[model samples]
Target: MRHLYIHVPFCARRCSYCDFAIAVRKRVPAARYVETIRREHALRREREPGWDTPLDTLYLGGGTPSLLPPGDLADLVTTFALNSDAEVTLEANPDDVTLDAAAAWSSCGVTRVSLGVQSFHAAVLEWMHRTHDVAAAERAVETLRAAGIGEVSLDLIFALPAGMEHDFRRDLERAIRLAPDHLAVYGLSVEPRTPLARWVARGRTVLGDDEQFAHEFLLAHEILTEAGFDHYEVSNYARRLPQGGSRRARHNWAYWNDAAYAGLGPSAHGFAEGIRRWNVREWVAYERAVARGNDPIEGKERLTPAQRALERVYLGLRTVAGIPAADLANPSSSRSFLAATDAGWLTTRAGRVYATPSGWLMLDALAAALTTSPEGG
Candidate 1:
């Protein structure tokens, strides 16, 4: 099955720590944007007639997809044919999650809403330069629930420069009270060129030290697990469900499964038939290319077999389902797995290998150790 991701790159304002390819513009031409995306979708289908697989998942991610009007959203959703039970998700911010908006979204085929609620503390929100207050976050959750959108996910951030243990615990408790179906908790990292980095460079704010961050991460895992959320992925947790119930985000799982996916709009990426392509990041350039009837792709790369294998290992280890035990036993790959296992960061049982909770925290290092040169020279 194939998956689809539609990127909406317009935001009302940029967050201090965001480094994604997003445009903070005062005015947005949503109609024109959606039309261009529809054209791109049609063009891809025309080029690859065999790309007619039923879409198992559809994700509307952004700068702020919620910023688009309800009618525009419905038009975009109608452009694609999705599976009967496709996991359709929309990423929204608290300020945009009004009761009317939530109702409109549900009617437009959005079955899940991932709210960007970084923190419930006023200080944290201010420090992050988020537009919504704590009350707004709480109200948004209530509004979504009232609108009958139950499969909701709340996002939280920890490891702030001035955040204390008590603060982290309080934030987790506040989020749990909302009773969301899912939670995505992430650690704060000062990315290069972000506003946060600039502030740290000038001594306006300090960055959390490694020890403090690790402690906060471990605490978050312990608290959420105790609250009955399954630590399915490094940054994701979900309420325990009954047997054969839906427990994972289909769209995210598709990426881990290496399923074919088509991405539309500026800065979007697409992978099909071993060919990976990305559109130009500049909106004007992308629009111009599409207007001239030229492909909007800025670059493309064909993956070699070895490169694909490495990618499988790299992306697989980050999830709950680790590499198969048989694959790990290869002489070239066994050493890294064995080393990590010995360090108590990984465990092997039956035919499956998975990272321990600690292992997930250090996943990047573990994956790097597993990747080897093709020649083994």
Candidate 2:
């Protein structure tokens, strides 16, 4: 595989809105986690032919990848056969960043760090159960710079509940002032069974409506683009270079382009040759499966032609590099193409149909309308 994603599921504390597969721990099991991953990789190498080949990108995403000790993190990255110029990314929390830790990460070949600075407001941070304060978040960015990391990406969450005290615009401005190389701006979703959902259900808090969500999304697009950041994907923006292109996240692009990637660790998903697979949801279950010399894959699906086509169109429309125009040659797509353009949802340029920020906010409905049929129905 050219790209690989290793999910590190250790977290110091679970964020209020988090429903991700994570094991909250007072003391992280760094060494044990690394050893488990090594075992899993070894097992995969035997079954998949090119699994051992050099990777173009390696993403260490997480509960908090930065929670691992620097030496342990280095060991995990070195375990992979990566291309010399491979883009290695680690997802970090602002409080976890230290100059020494960041320097060690760079020394071990981490070219990029994605900091989870959900919001710059202290109250919002506390409401979200984030471990760091605004000051720490700012310091983390400067520390990453001092460590000489090639790229720094900051994450922000907008469209919070009306009850929460936050100014989305101010947060955006603060993030821009920091001058991160990239930004991943996401809308706050009150996922089911999470603390946020419980609060909403009990009438303790209320999420914003679609209008608020749209407003915040558009506002981000305006501010970021005006600041010379390229809104390349639905929720991603990259700093545009003075001379030319933008500093896009290469690893994520692999997914947007439907390139096959291998995923390891609990709850990680992988897709190859039309088959999608995921590991066991719990860490203990995944570790046990690997220890027993069995594939940790809990289940897999081989998508049908129609399913694949719909997915292609859906994934394509989510990015700036949209699907080929010819892919939308169905009667349903052809009928709405003009209406969609007239509504300012998309634009056809250079033979590719690109979605505007507004269209991205309504990606699901738009993709469904434009999805092509396999049997020419």
Candidate 3:
């Protein structure tokens, strides 16, 4: 596999809306976590020859990969053989960024940093229980750039709970002023069993309606695109280079392109040779399994032809790179495509169907309509 993902599951505290697999700890077991990851890598390499190949991208994502010490980050990164031009990324909390930390990461070959700057509003940050404030978010970007990191990506959340007094447009403007290489703009979701869900269930708060979601989504598309960022993916935007190149997140592109990748660590999922596999979600169980020299895999699925075809349509529609018309050869899919195009939700150019900004707002429903229809697959 040319792409590798390592999930670091330790977090200082769980965010209000997060449903990710994370182990909350007052003090992270940095050394132990590093050792377990190393052992897991060695074991996998012994069994799978694919693990020996140099990686084109290495993404350290999680519960705050920046929480790890710089030395530990270096050690984990050094374990893999990476291509000279490989994209190495780390997901960091804004408060975790420091000049020293950023410099050390750059020295150790981390080319990009994705900062979790969910919002610039103080009230929203408090409600979300984020560890960083507005100032830290801006400082993080400056630190990354000052340390010579090649790319900086900022994440922003909109469509907050109703009556929260959030100014999403202000957040977008602030992000643009920072001039990040990429931006991942997302709508707040009340995941089941999360604190936000509990609040909704208990009538403590109300999530925004569909109208709010669409309005904010379209606003981001408008604001970011106008600022000269390319709307490359449904929820992602990249700064356009002077020569017309882009700073798109190459690692995530692998997923959109349906390429094989290797995933290591608890709750990490990997796809290869037509099979999709995932490891146990909890860190304790994962570490124990690895310690016992057993695969920590919780389950796997071998995708069928129909599933793959549906994925091709669904995933392709989420990107600016539209799918070929041939992929929708079925009569039902063709009809839906025509209807969507007429509704200003899609535009066909050069035999490929691309989703307009309005269409991306309804991406899930549109993709579902195409796939669920009779003969869709």
Candidate 4:
């Protein structure tokens, strides 16, 4: 099955910690971006003729997808043969969700709304440089529900430099009170070149230490799980059985499964036919390429078997499904598997290995250990 992703690269303002390829400008080039996406889509269809394969999921993620004009957003929906039962999701920010906007999105086949409600605490929101206030987030959720959108997910951030244990717990409690179907909780990471990094470098901000973050992370996990949320992925929790117990964000799952997907728009990435390609990061360059009837893809990589295997382990380990036991039995991997199991971070039952809650926190280390050969040899 194929999944599709369309990137909307315009945001009103960049958050302090955001590192995604986004352009924050006063005026958004909605029309130009839509045209380029269509051109890219047409070119991809001509090469693969795979549009007929009903798309199981269509995700419109971005700088802020809700920033797009209603008409432009609807045009994107019309461009794809989204399966009748497709999980059409739109990633939106709280400030962008209006009653009219929510209705417009629902009319265009958006079945799920992922709202960016980083924090309900005003101080924390300000610290993170978010544009919306706590009230705006509440209104956004109410608006989506009022617009008849049943599946709502909220995105949250914790371990802010200004956050405390009580503050983190309060955020989780407030989010749960809103009753969203899913919650995407993330720990703040200071990416190089981001404002957060600059603040840390200049001693303007002091992030929570590793121990503090670990405590908060464990606390949030416990709280959410006790509240009946499934810690399906390290950072994501959902109440319902993921469109009927299917194991993940379908669009993202495609990447882990190494399935074909066509990513459209500037800075988007596509993987198909064993080749990975990415578009230019600048909108001007992307538009120019599309205007010239060129593919606009700036670079491509052909995956080696070793690279693909490494990717499988890397992605598989991040989810609750864990990696297959057979994949871990190679002589090179057996030692790390046994060590991790012994350490209580992983367990094997009925031939499938799964990570415990503690293991999820150190997933990267576990994955590295599993993929590495024993001994420096």
Worst 10 residues of 1 by lDDT: 368-377
TM-score of each: 0.94, 0.97, 0.98, 0.93
For model 1 the local lDDT of residue 82 reads 79
Clashes of each: 0, 0, 0, 1
lDDT of 4 by residue, 6-93 (tens): 8888888889999887889788778777888888888877876676677888889888888899889999877888778898889998
RMSD of 2: 1.6
Full candidate order by lDDT, most accurate first: 3, 2, 1, 4
Please, what are the lDDT tens digits per residue for candidate 3 over residues 1-377?
99999999999999999999999988888888888899989888888879988999999999889999999999999999999999999999999899999999999999999999999999999999999999999999998999999999999999998899999999999999999999999989888999989999999998899999999999999999999999999999999999987999999988998899999999999999789999999999999999898999899999998788778878898898888877876533577766887899888888887889999988888887777776543
Report the Cα RMSD per candidate: 2.3, 1.6, 1.3, 2.4
Assess candidate 3 and give its lDDT: 0.91
Predictions in order: lDDT: 0.83, 0.91, 0.91, 0.81
Model 1 agreement with the true structure over 1-377: per-residue lDDT tens digits: 36888889988887999987787878877898899988877777787664577778889998889988888988998788878888889999999999898999998789999999999888788878888999999999999988988589999998888642238889999999998889999999888899998988998887788887788788888998888788777888888776733356778877876777888888889887788989998777887888777788899999998778677776777777787766543633566666788898888777777888888878877766666633211
Candidate 2, residues 85-106: lDDT per residue as tens digits?
Answer: 9999999999889999999999
- Return the lDDT, model 1, position 136: 94
lDDT for model 1 comes to: 0.83
TM-score, ranked from best to worst: 3, 2, 1, 4
User: Alpha carbon lDDT of residue 361, candidate 3?
Assistant: 88
